[model samples]
Target: MIICELKNNQRTDALVSELVDIWEDSVRATHSFLTHADIETIKLYVPHAIKAVPHLFVARENTGSIHGFLGISGQKIEMLFIATQYRGHGLGKKLIQETMSLYPITDVVVNEQNQQAIGFYEHMGFEVYDRSAIDEHGGTFPILFMRKP
Candidate 1:
């Protein structure tokens, strides 16, 4: 079972490796990205930035080890990662349900290449507002701007 927690001061208390492991697993499972290095970069800087924006939900195993997470920057989803082993049990959808109630509008950016995520977001009630030519370094990387209000 997945337990959802509101992001707060104790988020970084989760081990960095477990967080990275979640990303590593998810990216591989979804065929979205190439490696865990993106998460490695986050581990280096996200903790310090957490104080400025402290809302992050870290998923822990029943044994209390971090396995996946979803972070919110206001109503916008900043990060969502689920360890491969723990996915398909509804953690991702649960996180969205638990988080979206906190805001009036919720928006998420899904990389164009990630077909699985695109379908998942659509299933979750987010609608694609517009497609862009990669503004904000978006051109080379297509981003589906999804909004649910």
Candidate 2:
């Protein structure tokens, strides 16, 4: 498997949409810190962020089709998505490793009902630091902030 830098190509369109769908589903299943409008806002940010970063990697086969990607910005990992067909091939783990090589990541997963994701993040060595407070928008749901340090 070759993990190459994310390219500004047509493949990115599907990748962006897939990640947004993944995030939206995660929000619905978990009722997390996101509205549909917030998801839309993030979709707009992908192109600009991808262009600026050299570390966003697109995993590929010897044939060179896009299997997944890892995206990072600031101290945060913005997204990591493996194509459903390519999961369990260690691509997700590979994405995380490559992203961290470029920066010190402080990942924040809010309103996380998905135990699997929580486990995944923990397995990668992140620790919980802070939880959330109730608000009109944030609700009583706890926002868990995590860090690698």
Which pairs, if any, clash in model 2?
none
TM-score of each: 0.76, 0.63
Local distance difference test scores for all models:
0.68, 0.63
Quick one: RMSD of model 1? Answer: 3.3
Task: Write one digit per residue (lDDT tens) for candidate 1, span 1-149.
Answer: 45556445454455544565566667678754534665465456654544344466666667777667777776677678888877777888877786666644378888877888888889998988977656344335567789885
- Candidate 2 local lDDT, 1-149, one digit each (tens): 88766555543666656545544444444434557675566557655555555456677779866677776667876556566666566777887887677677777453454455567778888888876664324555455677777
Error of 2 at 93 (Å): 1.2
lDDT of 2: 0.63
